[model samples]
Target: MATLTATILAGGEFSSPTDTPSGRLDTTGAFPFVGALEVSNSVSTYKGSAVAISSNWILTAGHNADLNDDGLPDTVWSGDFHLPGYGVFGIAETITHPDFSGFANPFINDDIALMRLASPLPTWSIFPSLGSAMTGDNITLVGFGRSGYGSYGYTSNATLTDRRFGQNVIDTLDLDDEGSGLAEVFRYDFDDPSTTGLPGGSLGNGTETIIAPGDSGGAALIQTVGGWKLVGINTFTEGYGGRFGDTGGGVLIAPYEDWIFTETGIPEPGVGCLLSVAFVLALWQRRRHCE
Candidate 1:
């Protein structure tokens, strides 16, 4: 594995190593909706990440759905999704966005897809609400990707079964990333706290990190007053692999919200207005009692 010198963020001085290859593990079972995707055909098997958006619908990167690279989705592909604690479920169907360029194109856009599970997951399964990402927003990323420290980047020794959590802030919104002529994406750099004057200003939240192979289709979420919202779907990265200073981002969910809802028939959560009504009713009852 390769390694880089550790620099302190404050004074630009050398410092002892404080980062590790393994991102913070999700041992507490906080992310039940996030899961691993294993799709296979007669020739090969592909590993990626996905998140449950509804009881029977899953959201993932478009590339994962088109494993054969036929310009059309491999709807007939055999696959199973493994959600921690919930057991594995077979995939019934897949739908990739209409505008997604095939894998042959280096500058692919509209890299989003949805899968229907053979059976509905448990009602208690926590599906993240849909929302948009903005620059400087602290986002939570969860996936079963290769693991390694920023100093050395991702290592091939890691397996896709290793579920990990990390954090980073959105630094830029690229409207024409890869010149795909698509909508904007939420992009961020893997900042090393020890390094200063890096692009995006070394905004490491201690857990600063980036996505690796097998992390495609992972969840990029943001916490809102209502709850956690699914904001981006992990797609691609640029730089010397997943090393520090590399830029990685995913398809923003906002631009594709209508398409997702139309395909899945799942409505966005109405918690915001519903909660307000409930609170107002409770206050009225309390005043009536006081009178």
Candidate 2:
């Protein structure tokens, strides 16, 4: 499991995770992977995070799922996820990587987690539409995070913000020029600080947006192809704002298309085996001719 630590900004000071209330929305909008997360611990009490990925598999941060008292990953559990109209669903299985280290300082490694479901949920499986790749790329950040505006509720809107490379790192998008298609992977660090509009960003005291306790594992989707495609999972945050009052924060989303293929293995094992056998036979004949 990778040691998962919260990153506020690249060089900016760190801020603790806060459970602020995000304003309420219609709650009728599509929430992908809404009810897909559950925490595991016999004694220690922990709240369930979000699971914003696929139907069979759920994606989260390594810190939220690492509950084995030994800093090692054991198993994650989910009774149900708190969806909008629907209630929670019974979680079947949880798979946490043994290499996670939770959010720590010096932000060197990655902090990611995974969970599996016994039964699939078709309605919740549809991923959000993704948008173009560019720095300052306008995107929406929806979740049950702290509003930082005095109220505690879930937020749902297609707000715009700069889509940086990573949340905290120096690398951001080069939106000045763009290529065609959406095949490029635009990564954004959670801890990267904003330069201009933050409360303290310009003064060297700015923070980044953070996903509080309830917002863990939620989805950050972008508009693309008349639909929403997931970009990252709600991870943590610092204290800064993007276009709106909400500053960008750290997130841990599963790699969109690539992860899907890996989790749902294409070509099937049987088909792969058949292809391998045919290649071997052909090689054997070629060797015989040489002999």
Candidate 3:
């Protein structure tokens, strides 16, 4: 078993070295759909984060499934996904994006993957009808990995079971900083709300944060009119450490929504209407009332 680090957040007040278990674990159960991923190969075990997008499907980083960088799933690697209050489930299969070129270059892009669970979860989270992400949009990041304060970056603490949530605004949609000719990726910086010298100029939501090593497959979700929609998948980070001023982002879900929906058998919001007739009727009524 391998213990992996998680995410780091701005401000020393948000985290402390003494905060055992993790810097911040979501005890409120606000994000039950987010979970922890542990995959083991013949050599070593790897850890990451994942999110339940459907009853039997999970979303994660491509590298999590193809740890050997062979552009295919490791033959000996077995995956276990742990959800809060839901216990652990075995991954039946994993499907990495066809464009993922492995982790040789940090900026290669197309780092998304889908995992099918052996058994369906009782519940899951919903995605936007049209997947899209924009600059200045605040996104909620959730992951189960290592933890530390922005003042010093990620620590050596091991807490793979704790899930933490934080917020940060999208600073750019262009992958220029990640190199040219790469697929689209949305980037966000870890901003210190008390300082204005950062790249995004102190755009922190107070709980601003940056992902650490084990948080590679975590989620970057944005709230929408319908509900919370997953906009990005945490893939890579560009910084000395998980400290202040660090920039991180992942593959934009919009461009791969078609592949995801088709592979996972999850219908687009307005396509097949997965929700029950009564539920749809209630949602329609609610929308009408708001209108």
Candidate 4:
């Protein structure tokens, strides 16, 4: 019941890719906390975006976590899937929210997921603060998704290897209240700049950075009083290609911060780098596997 633009692989689809339109590669100087998520079926490889919420934990989409829908993964890894800014890291498992009932629940929501890394990240890695997204906040969407726009965009099976970032303002929020297909997520527009007053406004002046197939589980960041906030995770889009009026959606992250902390004992410090390796060593030795 949900229509999306994520590149399809094997039998699953990825919401957006690593390469965004007119964006640049994110290095430790730019986007060190973000990384590329890679999935494989032995012979083939696919990509998605992964947000490192903690030193040893990654936040991504539920679908990206387990692409096969069988609750078992053939292989999962992050970081070195693409580009040079990131280093390769292996994912131990995909942990979906207990309340997430796939993408077709009556609420039409809850696609959030997290992954555990084999080791803890260095202290230099940043953890974005948590903030509530309102209707008018400006958002920066980044990914290594497909390159090009519309028909020129890469195919669902395409494997892009670059990182890019785009900008758009929040079109709407609390979508479930609208009872529309966009329920449970926030939306930004890829409208024509000529089309003023369009919902969420067009991409506006300068380079229009819209999410394309391959960016699934990437970061939808919003700046707050504290600093840049990790507001959402790339979920889906209305159109497959880079057509105009295409809307990108990501699950809200602030709502689930508590669950993430309780499960992994990872501290929640959005702004600045305060991740203490000493605090999480015990959990590291006694990692609890999720169902």
The CA lDDT at 192 in model 1 is 67
Tens digit per residue, CA lDDT, model 4, 1-291:
344344211100122232333334443346666667777654456678777877788887776655554333325433333324446776676678776655544443677787888767777777776556767777777776765643244543434445667677777765543444343577766655555356555444333456666778888887667667888887777664656556666777766767788877756454234345654764676665321
lDDT of 1 at 124: 81
In angstroms, give how far residue 166 of model 2 lies from its true place.
18
For candidate 3, which ten residues in a row score worst on lDDT? Answer: 1-10
- Best of the two (2, 3) by TM-score: 3
Q: What is the lDDT of residue 243 in candidate 1?
A: 66
Ranking by TM-score: 1, 3, 4, 2
Whole-model Cα lDDT of every candidate shown, in order: 0.73, 0.41, 0.72, 0.61
Q: 3 or 4: which has the higher TM-score?
A: 3
lDDT of 4 at 170: 73
The candidate scoring highest on TM-score is 1
TM-score of 2: 0.54
The model with the greater lDDT, 1 or 4, is 1
Q: For residue 242, what is the lDDT in candidate 2?
A: 24
Better of 1 and 3 by TM-score: 1
- Per-candidate Cα RMSD to the true structure, in Å, reads 5.8, 12.0, 5.9, 10.8
| Candidate 2 C-alpha lDDT tens digits along 1-291 | 112222111123232232222213324455544443445466554443454455555665555655543334554433444444444555565544433444532231234556665666566356443223334544344554323321221232211111111122212421111233232223343332345345333222222333334444555556576576656555544333322233333332332334434654421357558889999999999999999
Q: Where does the lowest 10-residue lDDT sum fall in candidate 4?
A: 7-16
lDDT tens digits, residue span 26-101, model 3: 8888778888898898899888998888878889888888877766677888999998688899999998887776
- Indicate the TM-score of model 1: 0.82
**Evaluated with lDDT, which candidate comes out highest?**
1
TM-score, one value per model: 0.82, 0.54, 0.80, 0.73
